[model samples]
Target: MEGTIVRRVIPSDNSCLFNAVGYIMEHDKHKAPELRQVIAATVASDPKKYSEAFLGKPNEEYCAWILNPEKWGGAIELSILAEYYGREIAAYDIQTTRCDLYGQGKNYQERVMLIYDGLHYDALAMSPSDGAPEEFDQTIFAVRNDRTLGPVEGLTLNLVKEQQRKRSYTDTANFTLRCGVCQIGVIGQKEAVQHAEATGHVNFQEYK
Candidate 1:
């Protein structure tokens, strides 16, 4: 099987929106016929001149428009660091894979054929080899809305207060999936809170 792989990148800063758009334009210039048509149509229908038109007022709207395959062109499989103004946030990866199989064998004999009547073969024998190259294509997209005017700080103090408050009640454990296959189990709830508060750091305890 064969397929095209595409990726798009958007910066976390609004000042870079035009740059991101430019990147997409350049990519579209060399895309395959099918994808090129899609890109051209989307741009022509909704020019990126006005911020509100392409970059909606709400971060979600912009994300939905860009990632929706049906709405926008299917050229871009992933976008990264896409943000509007950093409140609502989303980060994800898109990937596609394709594979092909082939069979090879020769017919036995003219009049007399070797049937190997002494033994029988399983149906799996006719199948292709288990080893095959897996096509892997992936794209990553992250978006966040900027709400605060200035950089936020004071993480250590905030963590300490949170640990104290939680300690006042009781220790509770929490489990979170770090990624696709990793599970992080937080043990000693109070200790974990205290550690986070004191060091402003959290570590994932991994398990299968």
Candidate 2:
């Protein structure tokens, strides 16, 4: 079933959230920056409304950073797009064990999957009745919650595999490397090596 159901891999860049949204919406990745900017503007325009306590940075600063191509996107971006597009987005976080349905304000009658492994977002949708991938409104993607004979079952496994595949193309330096000697974790090869050298440790392992 996982093999039959289709998933789209956005680029490994920091703009993954935007790219994922664009893929699900059947838009070109080149147009993702514009979509990202739109969400940022919406947040900047109304900070108090969207700036929940979970938002790490202030609305203004977050908005500015999100516009940068190197900045990563997460719940903030997901929520903004859900509202801006007037559609429901179901996000499942494998690491955090969180599942949320956003943009319930409107009855968009459609939903899509945003798989979060705590660091990246990937788009997932049904393979369609005709077994073809086409540009269709994400709002029309049918998702069954009954978990019987639908794509929802085994979705977590599919998403986990997709995340692993995406990571294979990414630089290992972006991953968290743990020092085997001290059992301490650090991000990036530089940090890992530096920590090892500073502590006279050599062995290290990468944690995904």
Candidate 3:
């Protein structure tokens, strides 16, 4: 049930909505009422700057979509600067969902899983445009999954116990006598010695 699709967000169409919000949020943070009025007007007018800012240019190495819009959401905007290959990238904005705003409910784990899966798919699709091949992008997803599920606790202790057990049984031929006080050679050596002593022979011709 895995699938992927690739498409670029048109700068003219997408950047306008995003940029309007960004402008309001960036410049009118202290003026909440004014910001809201401006946002409403911008959304009503449907400016082009919003979408353009999103897919416009690479200002930084990584861009993020800020989920919460009320606090920071304005159409589409940059939220954080991320480092990618030693370069900084702007963050993109996304509408915050009920789950993101208020936290998940009973199906929290499932919801989180879905979110992660979607992010992986999007990252794969955007990899090429991000200057990485699809194969390399796949590796990023694989590493993310690996680290998310990797055992972090009690690992050292488990490895130590396993190593001890491995060493203890390494030499199968070494055995303890019935008296538990002396070592015996291989099973054949013990049997040969038993036969010689039982028959009271000084030397039993060695059997090949």
Candidate 4:
């Protein structure tokens, strides 16, 4: 029987993307360190592709930055991990409600899904039944068949709508943040950037 589609929320410990991918790929949430190491190795081995100009920093520096648990991952990491794992990663962005396909045109026959709400990530899976435990969840999908992907797309869109109605996201532009280093209040992403630039303090904790 078809199962219930649900979101597996990963911890927001700055490794949410890695953890989300880990959960979807291996049903393991503690693979962040290993995944980060893989990313570093992948980038280091291919300086031509992940160049300073492309990475916006020296290859070594980028690798070092990503190794830090405090750093967040996005498109670069997504693409790298997709290539490393040989699966098409479909990331559904809550803000745009759009699916960004990674590893597309690569003849990858397998696919996995994740949801990004600007600041956090979660794994998308299909459990054996409603309210079933995550151990019964299926995170992988087939991509070679168009019909096989139909229900998955529908499931992702339904999840997007569900999260939208719940307002389960932070408004990065207007969300308030307090500098953890200085305990100074800042409003919105711009102010946070300004605070970081002015005081060289990048540690911020969001507040309602």
TM-score for all models, in order of appearance: 0.17, 0.64, 0.15, 0.88
Write one digit per residue (lDDT tens) for candidate 2, span 1-208.
Answer: 3234445566756677888887666555555788878988888788777575546778877778778776667666777788777667777665444567777556665666676655457776655443565453232355444422254546545655665566532244577767777799888757864775588665666677
- Per-residue lDDT tens digits for candidate 1, residues 63-120, read 4444332232211211211111111111111111111111101111111000010011
- Least accurate 10 contiguous residues by lDDT in model 4: 143-152
Give me the runs in candidate 3 sitting further than 4 Å from their true place.
1-29, 47-89, 92-208
Separately for all candidates shown, the number of backbone clashes (residues 3 or more apart, or on different chains) is 6, 1, 27, 0
Clashing residue pairs found in predicted model 1: 79-141, 85-146, 86-145, 86-146, 86-147, 87-145
Ranking by lDDT: 4, 2, 1, 3
The residue-by-residue lDDT of candidate 4 on 68-116, one tens digit each, is 8877899999999999999989999887788898998888989999998
lDDT by candidate, in order shown = 0.25, 0.64, 0.25, 0.87
Report lDDT (Cα) of residue 84, candidate 3.
9
Q: Report the Cα lDDT for candidate 2.
A: 0.64
Per-residue alpha-carbon lDDT of candidate 3 for residues 87-146, written as tens digits (9 for 90 to 100)? 111111111111121111212121011011101101102123344443422111111232
Model 2 residue pairs with clashes: 110-139
Worst 10 residues of 2 by lDDT: 139-148
Clashing pairs in 4: none
Best by lDDT: 4
lDDT of 2 at 197: 53
